[model samples]
Target chain A: MTDESDGNPIERTGDEPPDGAPPGGGQRDRGDPGASDRELAADGGLSAGAETDSEPRIAFYGGKWASTIPLAFFILWAIFQSGVLGIGDTNGLVIGALVGTILGMFFARGDWKTYADTIFEGMTQRVAATAIVAWLWAGMFADTLQVGGFVEGLIFAADALNVGAATFPAAAFVLCGLLATGIGTGYGATIAFVTLFFPAGVLIGANPVLLFAAILSGAVFGDNLAPVSDTTIVSAVTQDADIGGVVASRFKYAIAAAIPAFVAYLIMGSMLSGASLEGSAALRETATALGLVHLLSMGVVIATAIAGRHIVEAISWGLVVAVAFNLVFGLSSVSDILVFTVTEAGAFTSLPFVAVGETASVGGSLYSGATGFFPLIVLTLLIVSMAQIMIRGGGFAAIQEFLLNSVATNVRRAELTMVLGTATINGMITINTAAEIAIAPYIARIGEKFNINGYRRANILDANTSALGYIFPWAGGVLVGYQVMVGPEGLGAEYGPEMVVNPIEVVPYVFHGWFLVIVFLIAAVTGFGREYIPDRTSEEVSRA
Target chain B: MSRFDKFFAGLSFRGSTPDYDPGDVIEVMVTGEEGGEVVARIGDSTLRIEDAPADAVNTRVLVAIDTWDEAGHRGTGTYRETVGKSAF
Candidate 1:
C-alpha cells in the first residue's frame, strides 16, 4: 500500500492479434496511417501496419509519473479555481487542460509526431464514443420534452392541486425527479425546472435557493434511477453488468436515499418559506389543456423505458410522442418547437446564454436541446484522450495499483474503497459520466478479484458518480443547470444574477445527492444490496 | 461519524459474504488445484478445500470455512458433502 508506483508496461508487438493488445488497446497509436495500410492489409485505423499494437514504445511524457503530471495539475487547478474560488467556468477548465497537455508535451521523451498521433488515438477510444453517443440521444429527448411544454403540465398540476407556497419546493422535487427519470438527463431537468418551475415557485412565494436545491435534487434522483441515464449505461457497459440488472438492483439504493430526501425537502420547504404571494393566485385561473396532455408524453417515456427498450430507441419514441402531443394539443406554436428565426429586439434581444443573430436564424427548443451537449461531448473526448495518454504512459495503472494495495485489502474494504474512491474522483472531474468511465476499469478489476457481482459493482460505481457530480457547485450538471438560472432569456429574464441561486447555497440543500452518497457508503460498509456473482449472470437482464 | 451514520451502518446486509457460523451448510464448485491445495468456488469466490480428493475437481460440494480470514481473500474450507456436478 505504501509502495511508490513502479511497473513495466506491456509493449505492442507485430505477432499480437488486435484483441490480444490488452485493455484499452484501441487507445494505442495506430501508427503512420498510409504506409501501415499497405503493410498489414489492415483498415489502417490506429497504428496498423508499421507496428504491432502490443509493442511498448516511448511514452510521450517520459514515463508513468511524468505522464500523470498534466492530469494531476488539472485536478489541483480545478479544486483551487472552482472548489475554492467558486468559479464554475468550463472554458477555464478547457484552457487548463490544453495548457497542461502542452506542458506535458514540452517534457515528453518521444518524437513530436508520435506524441501527436498518440493524442489523436486517445481521442477515439470506444468508451468515450459510447457515452458521447448516448449523450446526444439523451440531450435531444430532454430538449424535446421541454419544447413540448412538459413544464407547463407541472405548473398546471401545481395550480390544480392548490400547492401552497411552503409546499412548492417539495412538489417541484418530486415532479422534476419524475421528469428527469423519464428523460434520463439531469441537465435537461435542471434547465426545464429552473426555467419553468423556479420563477413560478418564486411568484408563489418560496425561498429561491431552497427551490433551486429541490430542483437539483430531483435531477440527481432521476439521473441516478432512470434506466436510460447515460451514467447507468456507462457503468453497466464498463463493468460488464446488465443494464436492466444495474437499474433494478440500484433502484433500492436510490429509493432508500430518496425517502429521506423527500422528507427533508418538505421540512425545509416549510421552514424556509419566502415572501407571501398575495396576488399570485389570480394570475392564471385555469391550467391549459395542452399543458396537461404532455403528461401523457412523459408517461410514454417512463413506461417504454421501463419496459426494456434500448435507451436510444426509447428516447426516440419519447421525442416523437412529445412532438406529436405538442402539435396535436396546440400546446406551442410550430416555431416554438422548431423555429428558425432570429430573435426580435425586446426581452429576447439581450439573451445571455443563447447565441441568436439578426441576419442568421437560430433554432428553437429541439435544436438547442440536442446541440447543447456538443461542447461537453468535445470536452469528454479530449478528457478521454488525456486519460488514454495516462493509460499508455502507465499512470492510470500506477494509481490503480496504489488503490488496490493500500485500500482494498479484502472484499468488504474493497467495496467500501470503490464507493469512496469513486465519489472522490467524481468530485475532482466534476462530470459524472466521464468520471464513471474513468474509474470503471478499477471498479471492474477490484470487484472481479473478489468475484463481486457485476451488478453490485455497477451500482456502486454509478451511485457515487451520479451523487457527487450534482452536489458540487463546479460539477457540469450544476453549472449547466445554473446557466439556465442566470440566463437573460425566459426565466433568466425574471431573475438576474442578483436573484439567481448561488450554487454554494444550494449544495447542502441537494438532499438526494448527499443522501445517495450516504446510502452507498452505508451499503458498502454494511453490504446492503450487495450481491455476489452468480454462475448464470444477468447479461440478458441488462440488455432487457 | 455521527449517531445517524452509526444507526444506518448497522442496517446493512451482513456484508454480502455469508456469515460462516459453525455447522452451517453451503454449496461450492471444484474450480482448480493450486500446488497441493484444492480450490472450490463458494459465495461467488474461490477458496481452498482443506481435504478433498483430486477427483472432486469440477464437481459441486458442500463446505464451510475451516479457517476464515475476513480481511484476506484466501482461506481453507472443510467439505461437508461431495455433491455432483453443478446443475446451473
Candidate 2:
C-alpha cells in the first residue's frame, strides 16, 4: 500500500500527502551541495528545488481526457437518437452513456492496464458518496412524509385559506416552494402538487398553464435552497464546505429573488382572475383536518437539519416522527400507509385479500404519496454514478481548472463563474442534482480563492443549477409538470400540448428561475449580500 | 550568482517562512492554453523575500489554506502558492 500523509510534511501518514497534496511533492533533488545556476534556473530559483519554472499543464488527450470523450459523444448521439433532431424521441440517457463510454476509450492516454483501475477509483471516491447518501436519505424522507399525508395536509390548509381562484396560482407557487424545501426534492414536489394542487386550481377556474408554471417555479425555489436537497449537498461537498455553512449563507440570496417573483405571481393571478368552481368547503375541511397531523413532519425535518445532525440520521428521525403522527392521529392504518408508500401513480388493480378468513378489498393509493419518488431515486443513482465517472475520468477537473484559470479573477468574477458554470451544466444534462454535483468542486475552489463566503458559493451553485434544470425541456422537473398537464383526465381539454406550457414555454412564466438568475447576477456585480459569506479556511474543508 | 537566484535559494530553505512583505499587492497573470488569462492579487505577509510566486502575490486576496498548529490541530492561513503567467 502507498503510504498516505496529510498535507503537512510534518504529519506523516505512511507516505502519501493529505488529500489534495501531491505525494512526495514530486521529484526531489538528492545531492546538490551548491546552488548551481542551471539547477536554480531549472527549479524556479528555489534553493530546495521544490518549485518548477513552468506550471504543470494537464496534457490534453491523455487517459483523463480519453475518459470524457464518451460523455461528449453520448450527448451528440442522444440528440440524434432522441429525435430531438426529428427522428423519434429515444432514451437520451442511454445514448449518452453508451457514447460517453466509447469516447472515454479513445481519449485515454495511458495503456489499457490502468483504465479499469482509474475508472474504479473514480466511481469509489468520496465525491460519489456525498451525492449517494444525500439523495437517498432525502428521497426516503420525502417519500415517508408524502405517505404520511403531508401533501393532503398542505392542500387542506390551502383550501381553508379561502384564497381566490385568481390568486390561487401565486399561492400554489408559495405552497409548492415550501413543500419542495421541506421535502428537499423538487421533482417529487412537482409531481405531488401538480396532481393535487394543479387539479384543484383548475377546478376553481385558475388558468392551467399559469397554475402549472407557478408549481414549477415553487419547486425550483425549494430545490435551490433546501438544506437536504441533493444539489445543495453536492454543492457543499464539492466546494469543501459544511452543509450548514452553505445553507446559512445562501438563505439571504435565495429569499431576495424568491420574494419578488412571488409578488409578481400574485399580481398576475389577480389580473387573470375570472371564474369560480364548486367544492371549496370540502377541500377546506379535509385540508384543515389533515393539516395539524402532518405539520410536525416538516418541523422535524427543518429542526433536525438545523441542529447539524448527519443527513441520514436527521431524515430517519423525520420518518419516524411522521409515522408516529399517523398513528397518534388515527389518520390511516399502518397497513394502509405502508401500501400507499410503494404504489406508483396511474396504476391500479383492485385486489381482494383474505385477512383472518374475512374478505377485505384493497385499493392502491398509487398516486397518493412517497411511492412517486421511486423513479427519482433510480434516476439520482444513475446520474450521480455518471457524475462520478466524469469526475474520476478527470473531465470535471479539466473543466474546473479551466474555469479557475480563466473567469475567476476577482470575487465578482468568481461568483459569476459559479452561477454561469452551474447553469450551463444543468442546461446540458437536464438534471439539476447531477449537474450540481458535477459543478460543485469548481464553485468551492473558485470561491475559496477569492475568500468568497461558502454560503454565497453554495447558494449560487444550487440556485443556478435548480433554475436551469427546469428551463430545459427534457429536465425531469419540467417533464413531470408537463406530464401532469397533458395526462388523461388532465387539463388537456382546455390546454393541449400547444397551450400547456411545455418546459420551453414555461421559461417565460418561470419568473422565479429568471428572477433568481437576475438577482444572483446583481449580487455578483454589486456584492449586495456579501456579509454572510464564510471563508472556507483549509481546516474547515479538510474536516468536511 | 545572480541576486534573483540567491534570494529564491535562501527563501526555499526556510520552508514556512514568509518571503514577501505584509500588505504588498502584487498582480499575478495566469495564462491558459485555450481558456484565456486570469489575474489575481495577493494581500499581505509577515515574512520577507522577493520574486517568488508565494512572495509576490497577496495571500488575503487569494485562496485560503488550512494549516496545522503545533498541537496537530487544524488552523486556517492564507495560501502562498501563486501561479505566474501560465497555469495549466
Candidate 3:
C-alpha cells in the first residue's frame, strides 16, 4: 500500500486549484456546474475562512491526510461490523458514516462551515444521483421479474432437460447465473436460489457444498456483467463510462471465467455426488415454462441498453415488458405488480390495482424493489459526501500523488495498483457496491493519469469487487446465502441440519469468482483488453 | 460502434506503451502541464501538445501528431480544439 504520511505533491498555484477546488479560492461561482468537489466548494455560498486570493484549502491538525479521518473511521467501522461481526446491515453503516463525518469536523483548521457545507455539496453530486437512480430502476425491474416466477421457470427448464444429480450443479450454476444477471442483485439471487434451487439440487443428489459454490459462482458472474447490477452501475458511473458499454466491454472477462467454472461444476458435480440422496425426480410442483417468458424482458433491457438508449429508458422498457408479460401470461396479477390497499373499501378501492385490506399500505413488486435500495442509496450518498470531504481537504490528492509518484510509477504498475487496490478494499467490505464506491475515486484518478479509458478502469474496479464479494466467508453474498440455508423459512425448515453448507467450505470451490480475479490479474500484467482514453469514448452518462 | 461490435471490441492485447504516427489525429484528455507545455499521457506513452489552450488540463482536446519517437514512446502534437470537458 502507498503511504499517506507524506504531504500532497500536486502543488496548487494562486491562479488555479485542482479539478475539485473552487475556480477561484473562496469564489462563489453559481454558473459553474462542475459536479466534483470543486462545483460543491464553488457553488456553496459559504465563505471559507477569510476569502483570500490563495486557494482556501481546509487543513487538518495533523496534515492533509488527517482530512481522511471520516472515511478512515467509517472503513474501520465497516471492518468491525461487517468483517469482524459479520453483520451486513447497511443502516448501521449509515450511522457509522454520519458519526465519522461529524467527528471529522472537530479536526478542521478554520471555520467549520466549509467542512459542513462540503457534506451538502458531496451529497448533491451527479455520480451519487446516477447510481441511486440506476439502482432504483434496476431493483424494480429485477423484482418484477422475480415475482413473475423467473426462478420457477429456471426450475422447469432444468427438470425438462432431465439434469440428473451428476449434472445438477452445473445446470444450477447456469440457471442461477441467468436469474442473477436478469435480477441484477446477487444477494437477492443467492437468497432466492438457496431457498429454491439448493434444496432441489441436493435432493436430486448433487453435493451440497459444490451446489452452494455453484450458486455463488453464478452470482459472481451476474454481479460482474449485468448492466443493471448496483456494482456495475457504481463502477461505470464512478469511472464516467456508460452502463451499456461497460457491460459489453466486460462480457469477455465474465465469459472467459464462466466457461471454465461451468466445466469445473460439471466435473465436480459428478465426482462429489457420493452423498447423493435417493430421491432423484422430486422437484417443486409449481415449476412451469410460462415464467421463462421473462427472458424476453431481460433481453429487451440488455439490447436497448447496449444499443445506446438511456439506462432509465432501457430499464423502464424492461419494466413495461415484464408487467405486460405478467398480465398477459397470467404469471402475476395486476395487484401483484402494484397494489394500494386501504383499511376500508372506498370508491377508488375498486380500481384494478387497489384493494381493501386490514392495514393501509402499498404493496407489490415495484414497491419492494425500489424500497429495498433505500438504505443503500442513503449509504452511497453519505459515502460520497465523506469522499468529498477528503477531496476538499487534499487528503484525496495526497493519496493519489503518493500512489502515482511512488508505487504506480509506470502504466503497468498503475494498472496493477488499480486491480490490487480494488481487491484489497473489496476483501474487507462485505457489501461489494459499497466497497466499489469507496475505492472508485482512486481508481479513476490513477487510470486517468495514464489515460486509461473509462471502460477498462470500470472493468478492473468491478471485476475484483464482484469476485471477492462472494469468495470470503464474511462476504455479503455468502452470508445471505448462509442465512437462507439456516432461516426457518428456507432449507433449514424442510431439510434440517444436514442440508446447510458451511460458508468456509464453499470458498475454494467458487470457481467463477476465483477465475474472474485471475483473469484481471492476468489482464493487468499482460495488458490484455486494455484501452487508452483515446482508443474509445462511451456515450454520455445520462443523469436520471 | 454497433451493439454487436461493442462486445468484440478490445479483444486484442494492448501495449503498456502504445505508438502513434505523424499526421494521426486523435482526441485526448490533457493529463497535465509538464515544463509549461500541455501533455497527454496515453498509457505509458507521452505526447507533448503544442499551442493548447491555457486551461487544457483535464479537458479533452483534438491534436494532430507531428513527430513520434518509437523507442521512447514519446511524441509531439499540435492542439486543434477543445472537444469536451471533464466528467466531475
Best by TM-score: 3
Q: What TM-score would every model get versus the actual structure?
A: 0.76, 0.70, 0.90
Q: For residues A322-361, what per-residue lDDT tens digits would candidate 1 score against the true structure?
A: 7787677776556666654554555554443344556657
TM-score of 3: 0.90
The true-structure Cα RMSD of candidate 3 reads 5.4
Ranking by TM-score: 3, 1, 2
Q: Against the hidden true structure, what lDDT does model 1 obtain?
A: 0.65
Docking class of 2: incorrect
Displacement of residue A202 (Cα, Å) in model 1 is 2.5
Error of 1 at A84 (Å): 4.3
lDDT of each residue in B1-88, candidate 3, tens digit only: 8788889889989988889899999888776665456677788777889998765666678999999889777889999999775444
TM-score of chain A of 1: 0.82
Which pairs of residues have clashing backbones in candidate 3? A20-A38
Q: Candidate 1 regions off by >4 Å?
A: A1-62, A276-289, A339-358, A489-498, A540-544, B1-45, B48-88
- The clash count for each model shown is 15, 24, 1
Which scores greater on lDDT, model 1 or model 3?
A: 3
Question: Per-residue lDDT for A496 in model 1?
Answer: 43
Candidate 3 residue spans exceeding 4 A from truth:
A1-56, A274-283
